[model samples]
Target: MTAADTFETILEMRARAVEDLLGSLLDERILPGEIARPARLLQAMRHGVLNGGKRLRPFLVVESAGLFGADQDAALRVAAALECVHCYSLIHDDLPAMDDDDLRRGQPTVHKAYDEATAILAGDSLLTLAFDILADEATAIAADRRAALVLALARAAGAGGMAGGQALDLDAERTQPDEAGIITLQAMKTGALIRFACEAGAIVAGAPAADRERLAEFGSAIGLAFQLADDLLDLTSDTTTLGKTAGKDVAAGKATLVQLHGPDWTRRQLDGLVLQARELLKPYGAAASTLKLAANFVATRRK
Candidate 1:
């Protein structure tokens, strides 16, 4: 297979693995003294999370953890927890007050599949479940490490991170932001979780501060690369290929690097980002070959 195809295969395998792990958890999600989970809430949660998503954040968690000899099961659980947060965000992001997206992962969005209220609750449930998974001793992480993971996830997903970025995005629709503003917005909105994905591994494995900083830089560079690639795709690709509504950014007058600087400039930026990410991995060498390839994939992915 080509490099893109190889990377795609690896991503698919990881996505499937996470999906299976999530399915197992959902099956046994019931806790003591509970008759059964409310069917609709559970169903909505499953609907929002399963049968869709690349599980990219989780993949980073697993790969980064691998670099430091972290336990496989612990890495997988952390990955799963990250996925839950990601899926929850997607569900909320599709709400009418948010993006009002109807399609996601080639299917109706959660609010469309179920009612808006149910979708909201489902998202809330998934978000909380992410923390629960992290806090549980079953994840095999030490208590202190678990607390650190929870703090990191909260910060990444909360006001100072993704939510803050999104607030900026919403306002940007009314008043456009400059290129720098766009960078900050996209970094927080999209990059926070990705950075967490990389950094979480070092935390789980108890890697040194320097290694964590390097991985964070790597993730931030690639995260920017991924967004630039996505912006290019939004400008050039069709909805079918995107698995969601395409061309909405332009329609919404969304402030994007592509809008500030045309596709040509954005492509150049993506190239630089991929190079930077690869350079960051040089210290780890072949251990990061797969991740290096993933960086390239983010830059070139059609979807």
Candidate 2:
């Protein structure tokens, strides 16, 4: 296949892999009489986790694993855990007290479809379930590696990373931070999980220290690129295409790359980041194509 065709094929395969992993989680039976009215919470959790999303985080995890010649099935379990954490974050982020968004992935936000309390519980459940799944029998990796994976994920999702970044973002909102502050906030809030996705894959694959570091760099660069693209899209794209509330960022008086450096400069920064990410993956040779394509897609995506 040509490069474009190869990318499309890989994307399709990765999407299917993510769907199957998510489906397994959603389709599994919840023990009866575990908790009072558990079904409601279960349904809410499934709604948020199973909702249509780009599944980019999981895809990155799987692709990174592939670079190390790891089993796809094992990699997928890690990916699923990552997605669970991500979906939970989104669910909470859209709550009335948070971003107060009413839409997500082209559908009603969790709080809009269900009550805010239910949404909060759902997000909490998903977050706990992510660790549960990672520790479950499905993970076939070595015990040491699995432990490392769990630690990596926790650090990325916990107070020092994504959560900390979000807290910073909320604080920044009150004061309307400058450009550097915005980038730093996004690097943590958004970039942490993306970096974890790549790192988790490498851990599962038992990649060497050097390769792991390279993948981490690749992940960090692409994570920044992804955030930049989102900022740009928030400016240039409409709500219909973005599947979420558009112009909300600007309306919220949040500082973004567009607000700081303007759209053209932001786009240029995105290109530079994509280039940096691609260079980090160069050692992987032919196996790096998917990573390169993903970086390009993140930088150039309209929505």
Candidate 3:
């Protein structure tokens, strides 16, 4: 098979693996410390997360760790934890108070499938579960590795990261931010977790700090590409194609790079970002091939 085909194959395999792990994690079985797993809350959480997407963040974790010959099982657990955090963000992002969307991944959003309160709790539970997974001995990583993972994820998901970025996004609706403001907001809101996804793999592998930094920079480049592609899709794609409300960005008057610089310019910028990402991974040679393709995938994704 071709390299692109290999990338797709690996991506699909990793996504399926994550899906199964998440399914098991969200199952009705209660762990030792938990008194009970509320049925409705679990159902809401599953609804928000179980609905299909690319599972790209988890895939990144697996792939990045693989580059360093890290333990696959440990990497998978880390990937799953990162996915929990991502799905939680999505659940809350679709809330009535946030994007107010009714759909996600072609399914009713958590708040739509369940009550608003249930959705909120579901998001909260998943967010908490992420750290739990990271800290749990079941993950089988060393203590320091686990601690590093926890700290990185906390920073990526906390007020200084994704949540803070969301707040800025909400504010942007009222007062449009400048180009620099938009970049910062996008980096925190969208790029932060992605950066962690890549860095987490290196951390799990106990790779050198320099290698971790390289992967993080690669992630930042592709994260920008991902957001740019998403913005372009919002402008050009339909709801059926996007699997969610399309043109909502325009309707909300949200500022994006695509809006700031026309689609043609945005497309060129995406190319440049992908090139930058690939260059960052060049030192790793062919081991970085999958990641290079990932950068292309992020830049060119339709949804």
Candidate 4:
């Protein structure tokens, strides 16, 4: 296959793998009659997770694993774990006290779909289940490796990473943040998990220190680029195309790159970030094509 074709194929396969794993987890772990009488609760959890989304976090985990010669089977579990954490964050972020949005991935938010209490529990369950999946002996990675992966994921999802960034974002809403402040907020809130995705893949594959560092850089650059693109999309795209409430950032008074820099300038910045990420992967040779394409895709994605 041509390089572009190969990258497209990899993205398709990765998307399918993520959807399958997420569906299975929802069916077996979330909905299997463990809860009492609230079918809507399980449905809300599944809806929040299984709805059509890019699944970029899991894709990063799988692609980075390929860089380090890890088999797909070995990487699948880690990918699933990453998605769990991501979904849980989204669920909580959509709560009444948080973003208070009614839509996610073109569907009703978990709280809107079910109730506030159920949504809270569902988010909590997904977060804990992420660690459970990592610790599962049957599909579990080596103990030391699992420990490292768990640590990486926890740190990314916790106060030092996504949550901390979110807190910063909330604080930034009431006031106009400078460019540097906006970047710092985005880096912590969104970039941390994206960085963790790549790092976790490398860790699962037992990558050397140098390769791991390179992948981490690649992830960080792409993560920031992804947020910039999101900011741009919020300004440019409509709700029908975006599958959620567009222009919500402006309504929420969120300080985004697009707010600091105009759309034209923000687009240029995204291009620079994507180019830098690709350069970081040059040493990986042909094996890095997928990463390069993924970076481009993230920068150019419309929704």
Candidate 5:
């Protein structure tokens, strides 16, 4: 099969695994130290998370860890935890106070599926559940490794990372940020978790710090590419293809690199970023082929 097809197969398999794991994780099984899993809240969380998407962050976690020969099962658990955090962000992002979206992954958003209050609690629950999974013994990783994962994830998902980026995005609507400001905001908002997803594999396997740094750099490059591509799609693609609202960025007056530099320039930047990401993965040789494709995928994804 062609490389793209191969990558699709791998990605599909991993996405399915992550999806099933997330379902089990969200199930109403009263684990230790948990009081009660409210039915409505659990349903909201499931609706928010189980709805289909690429599951790219979790895929990165698993694939990055694979480079270092990390345990597959352990990697899956870590991937699930990261997916939880990602879904939680989507849940909160769709709130009336935030993006105020009615659709997500081509389905009703959590708030629309349930109630606003339930959606808020569901997001909170998913965010907290991510840490719990990372810290729990079920992950079957070393204590130090687990601790490292937890800390890294917290930093990635917290104010200095994704949340901070969202705040900047909200502010951008009011005051247009300069080029540098836009870059910084994108790095923290979209790039942070992608960076963590790549580096977490090294942490999972206890790989050398240098390797971790290398993967992180690769992630940073592709992370920028991902957002650039997304911006391009926002301007070009329609809602039917994008699953989410298309042109929402422009409608909301959000500042984006695509808006500033134009589509031609953004495409060139994506090419450069993909090349940089590929170069970073050269040390792993053929084993890095999937990751290289992933970089290309991030740059060229239609949705």
Candidate 6:
């Protein structure tokens, strides 16, 4: 089969794998002096994570780690951990105080499915559980490797990364951001974890630093393409196709690269970025075809 087709098939498989693991993991967590799982919180977390989506971050982790001959099982665990963080952020992002959205992944968002307080707690639980999963021995990496993973995840999720970028995004509604500021905000908010996804594979396999950097660069490049494509989708697509409220970005007056550059210019830039991302894997030849296909997918996906 062609690499593009393979990318779609593998992506579907991995997303299903993530859903299965997340379901079982949610059931097994034990608390001190607590005999049963908190049903509401668990349900909310489930609502947030199990809604069925592309699971792109995990795909990147698996593919990047695969490049280094890393153990597939161990890489899957790490991918799951990264996914917990991604889901947590989505839950919180949909809260009444954040994006104030009522739907996510085509279902009621965590807050709407449960309540605001439950949504907060569910997000909190998933965020911590990610670290818990990383600390567990089942991940099979050495302590130092886990530590690096933790640190990387922390920076990407914390103020220097997604959180900071989100704050900037909120502020941008009030004041226009320059193109550079918009790029930086997008990099942190959307690109940081993606960069980690690519880098984590190398860390898991103990690949050479140079290889890790190259994959990380590829991730960063595609992350930009992903956001640009998303912005374009918001501008061009309707809510039914997007599975979330469309035109919200424009309504919110958010500063996006698309806002600065217009659709034609943004699409051209996306093409260049996708090419740049793919080129980083040229030295690995056929081994990198999946990753190159991933970049193309990010640039061209309709929703």
lDDT of each: 0.89, 0.86, 0.92, 0.84, 0.92, 0.88
Residue range 1-303, candidate 3, lDDT tens digits: 977788888899999999999999999999999999988899898888888778999999999999999999999999999999999999999888987888776678888888899999999999999999999999888999999999999999899999999999989978789999999999999999999999999999999999999999988999899999999999999988887778978888898999889999999999999999999998889998888999988998777
Q: What is the TM-score of each candidate against the true structure?
A: 0.96, 0.93, 0.96, 0.91, 0.97, 0.95
Task: Give RMSD to native, each candidate.
Answer: 1.5, 2.2, 1.3, 2.8, 1.1, 1.7
Residue 169 lDDT in candidate 4? 85
- Taking all chains together, the TM-score of candidate 2 against the true structure is 0.93
lDDT for each residue of candidate 2 in 235-254, tens digit (9 for 90 to 100)? 88998898666787888778
Selected candidate, larger TM-score, 1 vs 5? 5
Top model number, TM-score? 5
Pairs clashing in candidate 2?
none
Backbone collisions counted per model: 0, 0, 0, 0, 0, 0
Per-residue error (Å), model 1, residue 237: 2.3
- lDDT tens digits, residues 84-190, model 1? 99899889999999988887866888899999999999999999989988998989978988999999999999999998988998899787889889999999999
As for model 2, its CA RMSD to the true structure in angstroms is: 2.2
Model 2 Cα shift for residue 288 (angstroms): 0.9
- Between 4 and 6, whose TM-score is larger? 6
List where candidate 6 sits over 4 angstroms from the true fold.
1-3, 29-36
lDDT of 1 at 241: 84
